[model samples]
Target chain A: MSDIVQSLEGLLERLHIDVGLRPILSLVILLAAVFAVICAALWGAVRARWISRNTAAFWIFVSPWIVGFLLFTGGPMVYSLVLSFTNWNLIDPAKFIGIANYKEALSDPDLGQAIKVTLTYAVVSVPLQTVLSLAVALLMNVKVRGIHVFRTIWYLPSLVTGVAQAVLFIWVFNPSYGLANGLLRLFGIEGPKWLFDAHWALATVVIMSLWTVGGNMIIYLAGLQDISKDLYEAAELDGANRWRLLWNITIPQVSPVIFFNVVTGLIYAMQTFTQGYVVTHNGGGPADSLLFYVLYLYQNAFSFFRMGYASALAWIFFVMIMVLTALVFRGSAFWVYYESQRPRERRRRVHVG
Target chain B: MSASAKAPTVKAPTVKAPTAKGAGGPRREPLGGRILAVTLLVVGSIGFVYPFLWMIATALRTPEGVSHGGVSLWPIQWRWSNFTDGLGSFPFWAYLRNSLLSTIVPVVAVVFSSSLVGFAFARIRARGSGVLFAIVLSTLLLPQEVTIVPQFILFKNLDMIDTLWPIIVPTFFGSAFFIFLYRQFYLRLPEAMTDAALIDGAGWFRIWFSIYLPLSRPIIIATAVLQFMSYWNNFFQAAIYLTTDRWKTLPLALAGFQSVNGTNTPLLMATALVVTFPCVLLFFIAQRHIIGGISFTGSK
Candidate 1:
């Protein structure tokens, strides 16, 4: 492999190509070569009538995703798994250390802190965001004048990017001179040093996460809008009050949407990095209270150059997300009311009654 | 009853029109309850909107006034120079150009590539396509972190690090999520349309390009707007790859600005606002498509 690469470099250098352009030139050449080979094979297969023209066309159309999947996703996934067992920093030749990185993860204090902080953030923030966004959705769902303007105002905050939000909130939560404290002072109360305070740092991060609940609120509103009016009217005719209507009709009708939000939200919260990274100024915040799992993994990868260990951490995080998502899916079986299952549900109720 | 019957066919009624009648027949809220709901919404809107107002106000304040922050949205002293001075102090235009290039190219690339692939998946019945489609959807769950380390290594080996290639190139291959979105959209497209084109002896590419693509204006706009927001706001991959100033994007540059000038609140807010304005503007301009794209993904 080195010999082939060396000769390719020799050929490029001999051609007097600019050094920066050589990589790009070679990549183009490699892609062209692959394209030609695939074309030839496809042509041969078509001529031989081994595959239909539609089948051949399908491959040609989808080739971009296939090539990308192999190169970027599938290849890297396998490589990352292999790297998790090695002792490679970026500078060193990879040495197969055989689970040393994973073993170290078991007792690594920073890793432990990261897991704890991340889980706490996810646990606290996901449900709060789900419920809060749903509540806001219900509020916005009310048929009132100028509701669009109000909805837009509520959603505008979610448009701020993560880094910008973190920076803005740092100023907002400034220990002595910030909005949170300024408001607290107005109420004749003292606010803790928010991002600067050790105990309050993680909670501040959670609060920051809630600032973007408008995105999910819109989703819930859409779900709420889709509920058949007959369901509500029938329940109302049976003397269901507003509270009971919300509980029995609205909640079950939107449970699928709730399931979707919770799953995606949990996945997203677990991978939280930009907030912690920006808030802590690329360091763990306030004695590592805001040391999110991805941030710690990032530190290991880029700052510390522990590529192998970072890959191990990445896999562990991946598994944790998968397990959590699976648990949610398992639990959703009981609470998630699918409209398609209504027939069976009615039959079951009939038997029970 | 008439309004509720029309609701299902309207396709994204601006608001829940049926809820008015469905809550109870021709009912008005009690005056007290109405007042309470109004107050709650107003207060909630204030909570959501005040930080942004504070940001703008602080950006206009002198550095000293910023440090003495109060809950006032009124600046004591207007420092219009904060925008000029902040722009001058940082390479804002250069970063903005890089941001636009990375974002625009990917939006165009992903839209084209994903739609093509999505068309094939939705219309074509090749033997392995079902499994391939499944694989595409499954990739959506594979976290980017799981792939980032090796991808970094791969890009490094390709000598593409510290450049925009790592950030922009993979997007040309097509994104799993966007592909899925396009697939869902195309699947709903009537099969008769494609069959008519096919019967006219049009090729697959021609059918996709002429018939389906023209008909797919809504999904196209939705995907484009959504992609624009994501790529514009993207920080992590850009942070990993574009280590040099030559291709530093707005979010990364703003984060750098914050670190270097941590104490300069007015300047920081000015720069942050400049970085954030495009997304905010896009949201207002294409609010329907953005909201539709998001809820479409959720409901489906």
Candidate 2:
């Protein structure tokens, strides 16, 4: 067995696979071993009539994902956590440093600025987008002629995002000649340098983010259509005005949709990268004001070769998402009204394809 | 959507004809409110439409026309040469072929793998499938930032960097979000359909291949189109993985074009338009399927 193992290792080395890859390759081997064990156990169980045929089928069907989860997602997460504590440049053998990366991250001024910028972005974009999307949805739900045409046109901005969005907006946000400033000139208000101005760079990026709110608007339309029409009538009979009905009925009816948008918006805002990276030409922004947390993390990992430090930043981001998501979920009880769960909700939940 | 739209009106008998101005059953918006709403919608639509118009205009304009950017909606001179010269700058055909290979292979894999995993969770019975499904959903919250570095390291070690393998390989593994999407559709399918297949001495694969797939036309198209858009527009993965100019994707290729041809705004827009127009055209053609899939996954 030792001789066979030695020969196999020699064969692999001759194949030009790197030493750094040996760990992941071993992880893959371990995964296959575990899969083999599970298969043997399943076979034994089936022969002994310990588990049902249906249960076996489920496992067989689910096998690919289980293997994938372990090999790709769960394994990488665990590996990165380990990487966070070690000084590993991609080229070198990693040194085991003890919490040095995390300690340095706490004092890193760039990380501080990145965090501040990220939070400002999340705070500004989330609520505004949620409201804007909801308002648009409300209007969309109006039973007017040619509404779907308007809907299609509104959703156009959402079609192209990421790098293309940033590229198009480059001309749009140009100081002397771009459309944004030119439009502002129509009102005789001088526009800032927009993408070039440090004071305005973050705001310009925020506006770019909002350009695609029409995507959320589509969801809001669906939610609005889901609202019970009887509630509106009943509210009207009680002499409630349109404003009151909007405040009381329309909102509560679509609170679940609102909840979904807010959560996703928060998450997306926190990870704002492509626009900042593209617009800034991958070098943060004017005075690094547009340096988002993920951009900073990407720079550390790939650009600067500070892999361990980037991993530490990643962990910090993970924790923030966990805490923030949990908070939103916990607070959702007060605001979000799921019609299915409501005691007085009149209709049964029907599954729509 | 059709059911939701029709249901409230038929069931409740409250929503009146929208054209019934100031009707008693449903108070139509007053004249002032209607005008205000219409104005908002029109203004909002312009906000969305103008950028694309500008993009097209910029793409068609001469270099001098672009630099002399006045408030003109029409190009001073329609220069088709912008595209020829701009796309001619790099190995556009090579980059496009690279982009297509990356996109097509991954999209097909994602659809296949995700649907299989989703079917197991939806139709097959197991002891711990629920727990596994919950774990899958929770993992959706796991940021790519956390896994990106280690994944790169793993790929690097395997000598896969600068190749298309890194971008394409992960999609063969199931994406959690797409899994959840397919699972939702499969779960809502009647249990009797699978049971009938079982009674006919058929198996899980047969039922999935025949009944479930045939009935799932909308979702399959939606998933495919969405996946196509994602792969087509993706920049970060290409930036991280593909080092060579020859292997760059459309988005990365456009970025390179922008950097090198920075002075020629029209040429830059032309390249950007070349990258963007196909997707925008796709959105127009498959708007229904795209919206159906997105709004389906987006809400509950």
Candidate 3:
């Protein structure tokens, strides 16, 4: 038993010293096994006589996605989990290294800070965005002319992304010549160095994120549109004040949308990568305040070729999402008001039925 | 339900409209208050819009004055030559072509595949599709970062490392988001529309193509425009896949320009504007569909 174990260890070390080819060969073998399993499933599905059973159309429609799922999503996820257990750069043969990657990840100082920065971004951005978007939507929901034009204009910033957005924002936040400072000059308020100062840098990103509130504004506007003016008139007739109507009617009416935005916004915030990356030229902000989670992960996987460690990081990220989503869904019963419980919703359902 | 709330609050464009709701049992707001409200809104609109206009104006200015231009809304010295100079920074036309090619192929593929699966999930009553649809919905939260390493390796194995195939092939499969959008649309479609076609002995393809496809022009266009904009603006995907200058998309090229001319503000703005204008123009032209698509929900 000892001799066998020694030989195995020696063989692994020898394989580890080999360049590129063995890892690629191992991946190809795995790919072949996956392909064989996929072929068996397809064969079994075909043998079920879906055509005669009248479900062939469904399979045909969904076939592309099933193949894609096997290749891209499910297969990769499983492979990544396996990769997490092995220490291999693309250039080296992989060797089993149990729990080492996750252990390293937990202790990695840069990763800990990155996680904090990401959380700070999410904690700051999500609630502020929810409130601000609803506020803007209420403002725009007025029965005024040309509101559509304003709505489109407000949405423009949200649509402006990628290199254009990054470059434009860098200019907008430039201390000496940026519009933020130039406008501040008009008000006799000097703007702080944004994106340059660590204290203000994450705030700069949050502010940049606010520009996209027009997206949530549109969703809220849709919800608000469903609230008939008659409800407001009735509330007023009942001696309900403006604030009372806003608090009681408008807030409840828009709560579902607000919930949707919160969930998506939280997810988007956790995965914040591109703008921060581009703004800092991928080095991260001053004092590394903008060193977000995914940025670090990307650097690990690609720049450093620490694929095993990055896979571990990816697994942790997936778990975080799963936990957060589960928690939100569990907690949503208290906050997310479903209209279906109301008589009006029942009437609408009846009409549809 | 009411013909229209004839209250002055809605009819009158005034600042004091806020108070019109329960203002001493019924009274219109003062005209000055209305003017103040409109003035505030108008000023806020300027703040929202002027930067884009400023971007366009700055793009036309000579490189020297933009630094000290003090956020001028108009070009001090119109140097249309900046556009030409900006184009000279890299292989601009090639990058534009690459962007168009990458986006166009994916747009076509996404539209075809999304609607196909959408039709299956929404229309065909088949076993296991519910589970499939649920999987699609849940995976919507799966971040791309988790798969980047394996995806890179997979493509590397396929010898597609530097090619456009790595970027565009996935779209040939359906995207979950668009599939969901199409499924929602199909599910909400009037049953009579499909039932009547079925009575005429239409096959699945006939129902989807002859009846549904023609009627789904708005959605198809909306999906196309959105997909094109995303593909055109995609930085992360391109950064991972394309290494050679020959195949770099416009966004990557724009980033390259930013790196090369880090201080040339006007040239950078010009290049940025040129790269982004197509998406803006698409949005402007199709504003209705884009907005309507977002606002659309299944309802009575």
Candidate 4:
């Protein structure tokens, strides 16, 4: 290996390539070499009639994803699991520690705080965001004039990038002269220090989460647009009031969409990092109230150089997410209604008769 | 019993009827209810739009004007030089160039590779394809945080840290979500379109490039728009990889600026606006495709 590398380096030097560009050039060359070998093998297989033309074409097309999956995602995932059992700080050599990191995690108060904060944020924000976005979607679903303009305005805030949103909201929630307190002052009420007060810090983040409810609102609008008009008309003919129509027909009709949004929203909310990181200037805001799970994991890995411990934390988080996702999916069968399932139901009824 | 036999046929029109009308359901709402909804929406829009107006106003204000200003939309004095000052505060142009390079390269790379893979997944039949596609879908649920550490280590070993390569190179492999989008789109295209080309002895690659790709303008645009927003707004990987100012992107620079100049409210807002304007412009120009792309994931 060393001899080949030395020869390659000599060849590159003879070519007079710049030092900074040498590594990238070598990588390209390596990838091309691998591609050549794979192509040759594939050609051999096709000539031998071991595989069909369509199979060869399929492999060629999907090679990028297969290569990328192994290099970027699959390999790293397995490496992360291995790292969880060892002590490596990015500088020194790694030493096998045999689950010491996980053992320590059991007694770690910081991890506990991080978990508590993350769960609270996800639990509080997910439901609130769901309800608020649903309400806005319902309002936007009506055939009012110029509803598009209102929709554009509502979604404009969601377009702001996370860092910019955090910076803008820092001013908006400024204790004395910011917009939140400024608006409150107009109503003869003094607002508490948001993003600064420990008691209100997480709550303030929850409020900030609602600003992007337009994202989910659009999805809900799509779901509402999908509901059959016949269901509403039938309900009305049966003396169903507006509330009854909404509760019975509309909700059930869109239940699958609701399930999707809630599952995705909860998963997203659990991984909160950017807002807290930006608002608190890379610290846990106000007595660790903003010590989100991912943020804590980040600090452990990058700030404190505890890569192994961070890997353990990441694994724990993975399991938590898996469990939560499974529970939601398992619960979905009870509540989510699929229009396609009606055929099966009808068949079953026919058999019963 | 007969109705039960016809249930599958009955389902098709009902599913598509509301969508054909361009709006769902009858507007049986009374005038009073309509007026109330319109009023509430207008009021709520002000709340949603007020912060942005305030941001622009504050960005245009003098430092003292911002400190003394109440909750007002109008600036006391328009300080146009704040933008220039903010631009000059750091290596703004260099960072902007870096940001464009990182974002644009990834956008083009992801679109090309994803569409290629998606076409194969949707159109071609091969053994083990089903399992491979399932693995691709499963990766969507894997939080990026789990892989960040080892990815950093991988880049570090490759001597690609502190450069844009770490951010740009991986995108060439294609992203899962974009591949899924392309797959969903290609699956809907009639197979006969490709069959004709194949019967004429055209290769699968040629058929995909000549026939399928031209028909895929909508998906391409939608993927590009969505990918552009994500790569441009990306912060986490940029923060980890680009540790040096030599190749820092705009968001990373902005974060550094905030830590140093946390108290410079006016200049900060001006800088933040500079970083934010492109995304807002893109959203307005391609919002139909953006919303369609998002809802496509939901409905499917």
DockQ of each: 0.50, 0.38, 0.28, 0.50
Q: What is the TM-score of each candidate's chain B when compared with the real chain B?
A: 0.89, 0.89, 0.85, 0.91
Residue by residue across A204-309, what tens digits does model 3's lDDT show? 9898888778777777777776665666778889999868988888787677777788888889889888776787677778998899989888888878888899
Q: For model 1, what is the alpha-carbon lDDT of residue B130? A: 94
Candidate order by decreasing DockQ: 4, 1, 2, 3
True contacts kept of each: 0.61, 0.49, 0.48, 0.64
lDDT of 3 by residue, B1-300 (tens): 111122122211111111112222112334674455466667767877777787887788776677768778878898888889999878889998999999999999999889988888888887788888999988788987788778887777655666677788789788988898888767756556667667777777777876666656667876888798889998888888898998899888887777668788888889999888898888888787777666652111
Give the i-RMS of model 1 in Å: 2.8
Can you give the lDDT of residue A168 in candidate 1?
Answer: 95
Model 2 — TM-score against the truth? Answer: 0.90
Cα RMSDs, all models: 4.2, 6.2, 9.3, 5.1
Candidate 2 on A45-91: residue-level lDDT in tens? 98899998788888877787887787678888888899999998877
Off by over 4 Å in 4: A1-11, B1-23
Candidate 4: C-alpha lDDT? 0.84
> After TM-score superposition, what is the CA distance of residue A343 in candidate 3 from its true location, in Å?
4.5
Place model 4 in a CAPRI quality band.
medium
Q: Which is better, 1 or 4, measured by TM-score?
A: 4
Candidate 2 share of real interface contacts: 0.49
Candidate 2's error at B227, in angstroms?
1.0
The clash number for model 1 is 0
How would the candidate models be sorted by lDDT, starting from the highest?
1, 4, 2, 3
Alpha-carbon deviation at A131 in model 1, angstroms: 0.5
The DockQ-based CAPRI class assigned to model 2 is acceptable
Residue-pair clash count for candidate 4: 0
lDDT at B117, model 3: 86
